[model samples]
Target: MKKIIILLLIITKISLAFEDCIDFFKKERYLQAKQCFSQINQTDPLYPYALYYLLRTRVYAEEDYSDLLPEMEKFKNTAVYSYFYLYLASINRFKNPKLALEYWSKIDKEALFKDDIPFYYYLKYQIDKSLKKDPIKEAKKISLYFPYDRFYGYPVVFENINILSEEEKFNVLDRLAAKRMFTKAIYLLPYIKDGQKKYLYSALLYMKNREYQKAEYFISLLKGKYRASAVYSYIFFQRKMSEKKKYFKELLKYNDKKLIWKAANYLMKKSFYLQKYKDFFYYSQFIPEKSRYYSNKLWFLSLYYYIHGKKNKAAEILEKNIRYFSEKPKVYYWLYLSYKDINRTKAYKYLKKAASIKKIDFYVIRAREKLGLPLFEGKPMFLKFYQSKTLDMIAKLKPIDYKAAYIEARYFMKKHGVESIAAVFPELAARKLSDRKYLVRYAYPKPFLKYATDNLTYAIMRRESFFDPYVVSFANAVGLMQIIPPTARWIAQQKKDRNFDIVQLFEPSKNIEYGRWYLKYLDRMFKGNIFYIAGGYNGGDGTVRRTLKRYEIKNIEEFVELLPYRETRYYVKYVYTNYKAYQTIYGRK
Candidate 1:
């Protein structure tokens, strides 16, 4: 009995130790994880995973591929035997194409994890292409596995994309457009050589570039009535308010639903700047009742009427539009208020329903406050660290090993829902081994963090790259902070660092240092307004300043919502949101 109890205790200790190792692995402390895995007994259930990680850390993370032969030999007959073959193929794929092909052919791809499939296909294509396989067939076959956005070890050289046939070019163009790589899509135009496709691509490129005149010219060249006129009107709709309003009035002459839909969208945004209740209410007639903007328009209309002391109009609009905005707690709260003067029972019913729903948004908190319930129960219990057997297998491969668990966490969040973001936010923020935390430590070497406030720094870092040091944005922004090469050079010059090479921007410590210094600089320029700071960081200082000058921003919220670029508008909001989450997590508030 004493021996059995001792054995049980030992097992529990090993289990706890394994969990700790996994936490280190998840954190990307590969060296420490390797150490932890090295100490595990050979007979343990997790021993295979330990051995795999130990070899992987040595080869991939440490970049000491010299003595992997011994380790490779040991894993050959194990359940994870395929990984040994894969590692050899990956390292030698370019240098020894024949040997790499031999290694690749040894593996059973079906036995690999789902995330590993893309890497396998990508590597196989490279190997096959290097061995002089038919270019057309190889391009078509590999296009199936092409990632929408960037991925580790995916060859992004323009030559690879340039070789695709015309049909394949269109297919890849569609995918590139979906990924918002419009600039890269333009590269395919020379090869595409079709007039209509070239015209469409030109219009899209100009639109993306925000050169409306060029956009209008190309859009005019489109053949079809539906595509041409709609795009032409959209160009006008995207212009200044005065310009768009004139186009909107002219588009009203057309009986086309697309034109009408565009007009309604225009009115919805325009109404905010007009800010006249009566004018918007009058204009609301043009918007179709079934249009997506209809409910949001009614929401604004009802609120405006209530504010203007027209309770009858407010109640009428709210009652009619309640179904359309049911998911919005403010809608329920407003509907309750609308019923207050006429029906006390109905008012109480709606209020009660509104207060029952729990969310962190303004209306939910207001409803809870009105009901005398706690504003929130507590911060969410973030989902527990999750691991599975397949992840263990995936973690055995180089480079992919580093991202495997992190990718699984992302997949887990998607499988659950958006609410899972709160549960996984910390993991997402710190998932990559070379993430912001690693970079920030170098930036703030002293006892007290400096340059930028910790929360703000974290927010910017998360927004920039989600801690991916290797990330290069479609706009040619590089490294963890996504600093464009021109800006990086300027930053280098400003710092008077003569040794600053453009390639060094890809280095984590250098990237973070430069990024933080720029933030400090922007903080001075924007006078500490985070909205302006974030907007400047994303959409150039001049753009942010020009927008601010153009409009009399009623508040920070108004300024953020009305920013010219849709991407920059959301960029500020997301960064601020991330800052708040960082404060909550780190108790930095």
Candidate 2:
């Protein structure tokens, strides 16, 4: 027993030391991390990890890691051998391309870290090019899997684009546009030979970037059905009501089903917003029953008629089209609301059906609230003793082989954050585990609890970056809380923090601090309305205030649905759902 106690103490000490060194590495204090790593005794179980990170720290610091290559053979029998091989390949790539290729050839590509996969392909492309071999496949993989890898991917794609097929090129262009890398898309435009495709993409890119005049120029250069599509898009971005109505009506005359659908969808929403029942019904007919928005059209028509003192007509519309909705919690809730006034028995039936839906969503929660049922039904006790199967498996390895894998998993979690552990261990990705204790905890982690422990804080964090402290969004929002640099800087000034830098926003504590401060400020501005707070967080507070004044918000549900910005509307719903989920899971309520 005494011997076991001593061993446990030694293990605890090693774990603490390894975690401390990892903290230094995460903070980019390479020298300190290296020193910390160097201090671990060779006999310790964690020594292999310490040595590996010591070499990694050197690579990150851009210092000479060649001397450490001889020491890296120690990693061959360890779990981190794949990473060492990757780093080894990266180090020798430019100096001795053959040696890098040799090292890379020994690695199990499947074991490469998620973030490193792009770089691996990148190196393969470079080596293939250096050897005068066709690198089309590697280039395509980088473009498809990691186009946002600005260092290697974008540069490689721009250089080798001529070799890609037209379909592949269009795919790359579409991905770049989706990632909002419009500058790269614009740069590639000169390479596209097809005039129609080029013109359409150019207009779309310019419109996405909000360069309306440039977009209009490109749209003018277009012709035929494509030009009509472009005009509809251009009109969609403009605020002129007369122009929207005119072109949308003109769009209805075109035989292009997609453009007709888009025009009709827009006009339906607009007419509903303006209470033009005639125009709303006119446009609603153009919406195909096959369209996903068809149900939304039905809902809007029902609401319009219901509000205009036609309750029986509203019930008939909902009952007739109820089969169209695959996810019917919201539809059922709406039916309950519509029927409660005229027929309580029918209302109760619909309310019970909505509350009984297995899925938990905004409407489901509201229905449960009305029925006095538990908002969520799950085993919260599962979290109390939760332990990841991957870590447990690692712990069962031979003592000499255990710590490296353990540290590897922990380091991956630290770097990538949240569900990234599953990325490292594919077994964790099983759908069966989604509702299990581990995944539930993973889906709703409570990081930075000391800074702010509220359900809303965790909800926002889950939605913002999924607890990824180093994540930078397309809009340049940083860290777990997704605080923009300008907002973070302003927050620093408000707090009188003299030494604060925008880079600190990538630190979890500081990001959460600034984000929570901003949330509190919004709370005060909006007088504690969560819907407005969430909308303000995504859209601006001014937009939320204007929306509240523009629409007579009867309730939170109506306000969320009516939010003009689709992103903000969804953002509000997601944050609220996350908040409620957290509350339910943790028994906070």
Candidate 3:
């Protein structure tokens, strides 16, 4: 390896293909580099360079040297011979460093590129010093090779000192220290590549020796740059410098956002653990306003409100930001308690309002169950259209597929039931549905000017099903609104004054009308708790009501924190997302 590196360093006639192969080899693409080297047209005079690459390829490829051994015999007694010998010696059979050193020793140091001497010395130094055989002999051997090397350069040549410099020594020390090649690190210090490595390694060595003062002096060089490196992170954490906690204030100057966030949280935690709230406040600007984390921040301060005996101010902080919760239900639940403790009416009102929307389903269901009200949900409505087999099907055959459980609406339609249909009605969100037309035509409140005039629900339907006239879930729900057949039949009977069979629920028009009515009922019954509605839609109102019995608790936050099931959690999220999409895309907020 030393001979190869040395040859590489001085080659004035480097072939592009050889360089390309080297690049590929370093990238770990051994086969490609081998191929590049092999493909280097024998016609080129640089075949020796290509052959050198091929020699190294077998090492990386971990292939038997026999495949390339015949070719190796041709390169004996040349500059290449030394490299081949060194390469052979490096192949460990049983991790036998001494045996490998034998082949390396055979290298004719007398027949080498002077520039290759440092690399050779370094590799030999690594092996000898690592094995702890004899440092004095190894160091003396290193000097023989790197006589020109500064500082570590010793046992003078008959001529003046060699060209080795301070910088070279520093780098060598850096490599040795980094590799945990401690013997080499200590012995090769005068040849280190830079003073920083000397400082870093000295600090590491001192710390290992429990010489804290020397360690401090070494890392103290980093007074200005310590904040910018992973080194600080290692030192601060691994050293457990509890007393030097104040020193990390300098780390704030580092600009890595991720690291900063971690640092900020760490500082905040340290302050809390140390019972130093004023210290924690130093990073108040980076604090997340989200309830869970911010609440923790408040808890850490303790003096913010609770500790100061100003319960009212703390309660107000919770309320003003409850609705902005990153974790909705949990946040609202806390705010509910704060309000209830100070003002009962406000708390109930806030609780009811929270129950209406969907973020906090468990809490909402429990709230409605306690209130003896039916579940709240956006009523499902199936669209029904009747026409002879002659009418043309629309281009968007089943837009609900695009809904992908994502709901949206159609503004204008011109097929199935009648002439051009536009969902411009102000009252309902969109056009009339088709599932159960019978219910819409008769039961749609006779003063019914509202039914005829409003199509607000139609817009909501688009986001729900995309007007797919026929759809069903495993629950026996059918058609666009995804209404369960039994539920539809019951809803239809009350509105139309006539009972209908479950099969008729498949009819687009009848299914839609009944579905829409059920949706409206759910919405009103649960007082707008979107969460309960989505859950009831999937798991049924009975399940929600049943769950509520075990849900009562003094801490509202504790009540909602306990609901399990990932799907229900997301079900509530998407439904509200649908609501927001409807409002944003169609302006029906």
Q: Rate residue 429 of model 3 by lDDT.
A: 25
Model 3: runs farther than 4 Å from truth?
1-218, 227-244, 249-264, 281-304, 307-309, 321-325, 349-589
Q: Write the candidate numbers in order of decreasing TM-score.
A: 2, 1, 3
Worst lDDT run of 10 residues, candidate 1, spans 439-448
- Runs with alpha carbons beyond 4 Å of true place in candidate 2: 1-36, 43-45, 56-80, 108-115, 129-147, 235-243, 274-282, 288-292, 306-316, 379-407, 410-443, 470-476, 498-503
Instruction: Return the top candidate by lDDT.
Output: 2
TM-score, each model? 0.58, 0.78, 0.27
Task: State candidate 1's TM-score.
Answer: 0.58
Which has the better lDDT: candidate 2, or candidate 3?
2
Query: Which candidate should be chosen as best, given TM-score against the real structure?
Result: 2
Candidates sorted on lDDT, descending: 2, 1, 3
Model 2 C-alpha lDDT per residue in residues 541-577, reported as the tens digit of each score: 9878777786666667667766767678788887887
Clashes of each: 0, 0, 63
Q: Tell me each candidate's RMSD, in Å, in order.
A: 10.9, 6.7, 27.0
Local accuracy of candidate 3 as per-residue lDDT tens digits, 474-517: 44566556776667667767788475777665554565567567
